[model samples]
Target: MLRCNLICIGKLKEDYWRKACEEYEKRLHSFCRFTITELPESRLPDNPGKAQIQAALEAEADRILNLTANTFAAALCVEGEPVSSERMADLIRTLSLHGTSEISFVIGSSFGLSDRVKEYASIRLSMSAMTFPHQLARVMLCEQIYRAFQIINHGKYHK
Candidate 1:
């Protein structure tokens, strides 16, 4: 089975998001081995300056890199290249052919990812140009991953 990892900064504090994520995770188990890791978000004062936010993002980037050091990393960003479900399926197949059974996807906090993290990504993926809360993004990512698996298995999801 394919091994996929998700590294995100900050815990999901909302029960609804947690439940949604769990549901997708359970579904994904039938197709692949998945691991989701959450890192602590840097504590900053309310109304923090740009510099402070950048510093926080930088710190999170360091932690994320270490967490995903062993896998091919993809950073989720607003300006990243978008791919269709068929394309994503193809990409997964290509990865599998290259003997990269393990792949890691990283999502940053509300402030977004640092340049260092972006630079390190093997690919950068964008769900949409519109912004989404990190919690919702996690659920969406999980669902898409499950859908990707379904597409690969010739299941009904791609239709």
Candidate 2:
């Protein structure tokens, strides 16, 4: 089975978000071995300066990189290439065919990811140009990943 790991920063404190993630994870069981690893987000003040935010993102990147070792890394960022659901499914299939059974997706905190993280990514994916709450992003990503699997399998869940 393919191993899909979602390495995200920050915890999902909302019940709804957790429930939503759990649902997708359950649905994905037949497709791939999935795991969600939440890393600690760097603390910042109410009004942090650019430098401080950059520093924090760098720190988070270090942790993310460490956790994603030995996997094909994909970083979720606003500047990343946006793809349709079908394309995502194709990408997943291609990776699997290439013998990359382990795929890791990195989701940065509110301040976003550092350059180092982006550089480390084998592919950069963007959900949208608009910003979303990190917790909610996790749920969305999980759903999309499940949908991708369904699409690959020609299952009705994706349609």
Query: Best candidate, lDDT-wise?
Result: 2
Give the whole-model CA lDDT for all candidates, comma-separated: 0.88, 0.92
- lDDT tens digits, residue span 56-143, model 2: 9989988999988889999999999998889889999999999998999899998889999999899999998888888888998999
- Relative to the unseen true structure, what is the C-alpha lDDT of residue 21 in candidate 2, on a scale of 0 to 100? 95
Compared with the true structure, the alpha-carbon lDDT of candidate 2 equals 0.92
- For all predicted structures, in order, the TM-scores are 0.95, 0.97
Q: Write the per-residue lDDT of candidate 1 for residues 52-111, one digit (tens) a residue.
A: 999999999889988878678989998788877677778777898899978898999989
After superposition, candidate 2 runs with Cα above 4 Å error: none
What C-alpha lDDT, on a 0 to 100 scale, does residue 60 get in candidate 1?
Answer: 93
Best by TM-score: 2
List residue ranges in candidate 1 displaced over 4 A.
Answer: none
